[model samples]
Target chain A: MNKPKPDLSVRIGGLVMQNPVMTASGTFGYGPEFARLMDLNRLGAIVVKGISLKPTQGNPTPRLVEVPGGLLNAIGLQNPGFDGFVRDYLPFLRHYRAPVIVNIWGHTINEYASIAERFNDLPGVHGLELNISCPNIKHGGIAFGTDPKMARRVITAVRARTRLPLITKLSPNVTVIAEFARIAEACGSDAVSLINSFPAMAIDIEARRPILANITGGLTGPAIHTIALKMVWETARAVKIPVIGMGGITSAREALAFIIAGASAVAVGTANFSEPLSTLAVIKGIEAYLVRHRLPSIRALVGTLETGAVIPKPRGPGRPCA
Target chain B: MLIENTIILSHRLLKGGYRLLTLKSKRIAPMVRPGQFVHLRLPSPADAVLRRPFSVFRAQAGRLAILYKTVGKGTQAMATLCAGDEINILGPLGQGFPNVRKDTLPLLVAGGYGMAALYLVAQRAPVKGIVFVGGAGADDILCADDFRRLDWDVRVATEDGSAGKKGLVTRILDAWLNKELHGRQPEFFACGPNGLLKAICKRVGRGGWDGWISMDRHMGCGLGACLACVQKVCKRDAAGRETWAWARVCTEGPVFACRDIVWD
Candidate 1:
């Protein structure tokens, strides 16, 4: 007489998420910044702002600029050190029902391992989102993420240090992103999240200078959505491990596309800045999609995109032939 | 903080291309404190992914108002909003100006539309003192009468000699400190451009008096999550050693003490 509730649970390595929706790091801050606005427990996981080995001060002022469909931010990975996060944020986050994925970054391979090692015995942390891909930072962030050999070294070093689920957040700047994903798999990374914001710039024509103090910042939001989707599709096919898709997801439609393309999960980044209730909305939308399509569970939707057999439909007059 | 689909009660253009937007937000209006702001998602600028933050000019009953100029794409888009249109707003955000101390005289300083942020500060002050406002010209000055209606002494200054005093607001303030001073300690609440705020900060530092400044920066997320609007402020440890730290302007401030700011 009744239909069953669609099962939305997803897992990234050992961490089990109630749904596939996650709050991207940097955009979500720590778990508490948004807790007052939205339920922290509702998200699949809360991927907090990146943390480093030592306390980082970030960049100078004029750190953000809004473009047509997105924004460019040069926040420069400003964050509390590993100890600072453990002491100030961990206890508060441990109380949330959703898993806490700490985004960790460093200036060197050793720093990456050291940061990972500190979180090993931490009671609250469910996983580490290795942020080798932040484009804003001058040093470790942009460097380690773009270089293939270095990406392997950093992932390997961090994998050796922490027993927690390791996620290598890959950069979109690379020519072939799948090669890096395969490297992460080889290095023992449990999952991979792609793509981080694209390296971008905005200029003030009147001032004749870059709008951001850092000149170049990472671009995120609707503009990068399609590009990120392609990268997710590529990386998903490249690795057997879970692929967490992110970049410009503002609603469930984009999240669904990610899942259909092959993402095991989706992370809401810039959308969190615009709408704090977006994660809840995305989760609800995904469930509605599942019910509408009569899919038994979210797992069934993963990599369900049909390919290689479809013909194109013709548009109205004056359009090129399909 | 709340995100509400507030309906526009009225939208009118005042002197100098400024738009005074009134919204019926039973959920958020009553929660507003002086100097707090609302981030509006403009209807036009469909490509815009960020919400623009505006200072609360007035909040009462089940309605709130923000007085802003058509400065950028976002505000220009806001000009297209009319009565009964729904607008998404996240509000009563950031810390507002603190209460005027009992023993201190409350002096309100503003620059142009900055006066909008200080109205409640003036109305709520236990004692009414002098209000000094400045702008580039008469067209740039706004809301001087609103303060006058509140029975507070209002002083005006324009750089082009088109208004009250023929120089900066600080010049008139200096004159008051010299002639009107019978040894009354004044606590200052100011909102203006960075230059005007820095000038007020200099005076606050010299007089050893308290001054609160509302800073306006390019904000990405009005909620402190984005780390887009950050101001460096001096922090002290248990040992009293001072270190400068980046405090989010969208959360820790929009209002910060003049003394704590470490200007770049």
Candidate 2:
């Protein structure tokens, strides 16, 4: 008899996926942008770009710039409104076997609730990845993802308005990310996705001007991997709900790091830009790792980090390290 | 429209840092339309930069070539690539130049290495026409002989007075419009810097003739996912109202109609 295949299935609240690798919102346009390049059915889930109630024109030219190990972008949530997305992208997404998680964002609590209510009625939407951590936008994004109170209110408002599973995408700009994770759980969030691009900026020395038209953008890529891994571990420890870890995930090793760090699932972000097939590579790599380790399922690998020999506490708090 | 690992047949560096890279591909080369580009991932110590896009300079039976100048860290690293190296490429992408119209005479315009993008157009055109090639100096002007070999009338202009006409290309184009054309309508096919494209668009609009210009933008994900390369374009609504919208340069076009573009 053939050896049994390793199970890669994972679940986050009501959303069930074939695998644990998902496309980070915005990195994977609705469904068709990358459909021609790779098989969409293989993804754990597909998170389309962020969408709002009304169509947005977005920011001006020069929306992106590259640094040593990351890319900064200030796209300002340019998207086809709900109506446009439903008319143009939904039917296409429904054709795929992968679960469709529509990433939704709004400038106000009311806007968030309103769009949430609207999407709640949509049949094809599997979940809502609430984008409160987008740093490039002028309002609503980092403002809600960073502030504990606003985060709670928006999550609560959206939770009440929509019955779909809510995955709050958190910001890394705050001092304590775990506190926000607790708030997301307290406010009825089903799961939490951590570290949406750290707020960042780059400058042109010769021109002495900001590289992006929006002045500052969000940093995403290998540069933020370690930082995001730590945050995912912290948030995972602080909450009972599944943690979806992301930020600069380029390979299977990195995705496995998130799972071992306690993320129930992982999303491929900037790496999608580098390699359109990065998600597939990550999915394949994760399976190989599981088979090598003899894990029963991906769920068995979640939060399995072995911190061998914990360091003794530093002798009291000394003079604040300068 | 497809991703393939193409083998480098040749990597040659010409003077002025311009490099011509030839790759052998069964899928990309033979299928590429004129003005389309390939998203090339050059090997580096760290994969920091996103894939770089280069318009197909020449494409034919299982082989394609890209002519690029070393201007950034990506291209600088790409220079180290040798023949027989395998590079990952997503290619033959974006809407390319449409076929020449039967009723109008074809006019080719290029700036500097922009001639690389228009070579296929000249070769594919049913009838030969005037080609306006301009640059800052003699060294900057490229590929005039290729057009001449194909029997297209090539006009060279250098701003520094180091080659051909001692002024901008507009000086020579104005002279042609004043005497050369015996009233045959001209449809322009241009690929160049924004300034040259704008100038061509202006003349085309003024003359009420058909024109297409290939656009160059700072791109990420040469796929449409990144939203990095966006160009504001005119969109027509149900009521026939002209409004503005952002079009992804990597997907919708590296080529667009002269009249449809809003310069601002």
Candidate 3:
């Protein structure tokens, strides 16, 4: 008698993931750091910490300060720049079992294209994750993410440089996320990951001042999981390409919700900080959910939105669906 | 060695701003030495990214324990953890102390929470060694009973005079070295605030003495990439090519020889 194997395969853009779970950029730090703690091979894909055209010193001390139910960091995209990342990080990443997606950030549209062009032919780099939303820096950090026109221009510029699959990371601090997702899609972005950090702050009551040196920080944790899911659903519906949903996923159930909401795959960010094995747990959870539901593959759940699905009415004072 | 497994055995309060957390990981425990640490992901989600590094206070029988002071939200959340919980822990990382020689008289020195990093060495050192511990006050002094149980000479000096000697631990070390410690060759193992370690290094000098110190720095990607935790060293290559590169405190060392380290 043959035992059933778990259906854990997932595809995003042109890359195939053994599982839908991946480590979010910045959180996993280039993949080698966690090697001593866990197996890098078990992960579906490792999205390395954000890289830029040039080295970044990041922000000053008190760069990270903890807040309620989460943390706030103004690390300011501190990386070794493109040359160092390619020379140093990419070589080691090739040894890992999973695909390595290098997350790139830049100060200008051409800078993004330049970095993309540089990495277009490198070995071991499976895809490019455009980190268009970074709140910790001063320059083009959050510029492209917050404005649709800039986002399109940045995405278009990079698209013109390489054939590598592009995944544009979206920022949550926008008024219309669906509009931005549509623009990114039209600009030739292969997939979109939503949403990046929600700009938030925490104050030190005793000091009567903000805890972080940079008064504001990006919020992430279970506190913003729902918000991320909503954005992912909206973006997935707005664009024809895949959506890599991530925000506050700490377990398999939460990951499944993203899949049901139309995310082609999911990224586990803050949950990694809480539990290093969280990505593995999410992958296991997705497999278990698929097996129990009698689904043949994960693709069945991707973009499974039922048009005209009933909207639950609020239990309080009375508003019926139109 | 790779992390074979990880389990949070227990998390309990010890005193003000301090906690005793036990992590059971066979992989980390087997390879860990005194003065090394593990970088733990603080259960915070991605956007609030970054892992916090904690020194390995004690390791035995496939288990590692850390004594951490709750300074912020990351540690506060760590404090709330209970038995059977698990956090992502990457370690047995950084350089640990050189193996204690049988003939040398080992001297273990620490300050405040710094005691946490030195406790294991004190317990493991040969019976002939002396353990000199210091802290802000009596509350800051830790693991005295454990060291005493090992039959090592355990001395305590507190700033507020609420414990052993009525002065700073360095003063006690100075007095002991000049008086009772005369003519003996003691290899020192120390870990504490940079200023305190600097003062100790200055007094001890580099002649006829061998010692190791563990340094601390803000780190990102505990491996090497971010270059957030770089430290200077004193030595240079044969061609005077500065053999002292910017060593990563996370991977290259959390511990280094006293003569090799360049303290600011």
Which candidate wins on lDDT? 1
Q: Candidate 3 on B1-264: residue-level lDDT in tens? A: 443447888887886578889988877786788888888876554434567789988899988899999876667767777889777677767888877888778888888888789877876665457778888888888777777777878889998899999888888888888888768778888888887778667766744588888888866556654445667777675588755445667777888777777755
DockQ of each model against the real complex? 0.79, 0.75, 0.27
lDDT against the true structure, each candidate:
0.90, 0.89, 0.79
- Estimated TM-score per prediction? 0.97, 0.97, 0.82
Shift of residue A166 alpha carbon in model 2, Å: 0.8
**Top DockQ prediction, candidate number:** 1
For model 1, residues A104-215, the per-residue Cα lDDT tens digits are 9998999999999989878888999999999988778868988887887898899999999999999999988888888888888999999999999999999999999999
Question: lDDT tens string, model 2, A1-322?
Answer: 8656789999899899999999999988897989998899999999999999999878887999888988888998999989999999999998989999999999999999999899876878999989899887788888998777788889889999999989999999999888888888878889999879988899999999999999999889999999999999988877789999998888899999999999999999899887999999999999999989988899999999888967443233222111
Model 2: CA > 4 A from native: A309-322, B237-239
Model 2 lDDT tens row, B50-114: 88899999998899999888888998989999999999899878999999877888988888899
Of 1 and 3, the candidate ranking higher by lDDT: 1
Q: Look at candidate 3 and give me any clashing residue pairs.
A: A269-B46, A270-B45, A270-B46, A273-B43, A274-B43, B236-B243, B237-B243
Computed on C-alpha atoms, the DockQ of candidate 3 is: 0.27
